[model samples]
Target: METVIVLSRLQFAFTVMFHYIFPPLTIGWGSFSPIWKRVTTSPENRSLPPLPSSG
Candidate 1:
């Protein structure tokens, strides 16, 4: 019973830790995408289209 509880705690901890990693990655990518788009679409860039609106 004690072993089961320890294992359960470990599993929950691992799940929470792993789950926490993705959002920041997604947010970083989400933020970086617009910056990248802007850099690519600047008049100096002249190759890519204007950045799309978030709405």
Candidate 2:
């Protein structure tokens, strides 16, 4: 019973830590990727048109 309780606590802690750590790491990568692309890419090669704003 004690071992089961300890294992359950460990699993819960792992889940919480994973959830806390994973998102910002991914979000940081997602956010930085565009800037990295822009830095690496030449302006002339970027051919996408600007979208019109609804506001």
Candidate 3:
């Protein structure tokens, strides 16, 4: 009985940690993937915007 309870608690903890880690990884990829595609697809002649000068 005690071993079953411990196993259940371990499974619950594993799921919670997985949920916490997976979303951020997917979200980051979703956001960056578009930028990555754009960079690769953009024309070579197109110039990037100039950086702002520090005052």
Candidate 3 lDDT by residue in tens digits, 5-44: 9999999999999999999999997897677667655898
> Candidate 1 has what TM-score?
0.57
Candidate 3 ranges with C-alpha deviation above 4 Å = 45-55
Clashes of 1: 0
Predicted candidate 1, C-alpha RMSD: 4.2
Of the pair 2 and 3, which is ahead by TM-score? Answer: 3
Ordered from best to worst lDDT, the candidate numbers read: 1, 3, 2
* Per-residue accuracy of model 2 over 1-55 as CA lDDT, tens digit each: 9999999999999999999999999999789767666655667756654433338
The most accurate candidate by lDDT is: 1
Q: What is the TM-score of each candidate against the true structure?
A: 0.57, 0.72, 0.74
lDDT on C-alpha atoms for all candidate structures: 0.87, 0.79, 0.79
Q: Ten-residue segment with the worst summed lDDT in candidate 2?
A: 45-54
What lDDT score goes with residue 37 in model 3? 62
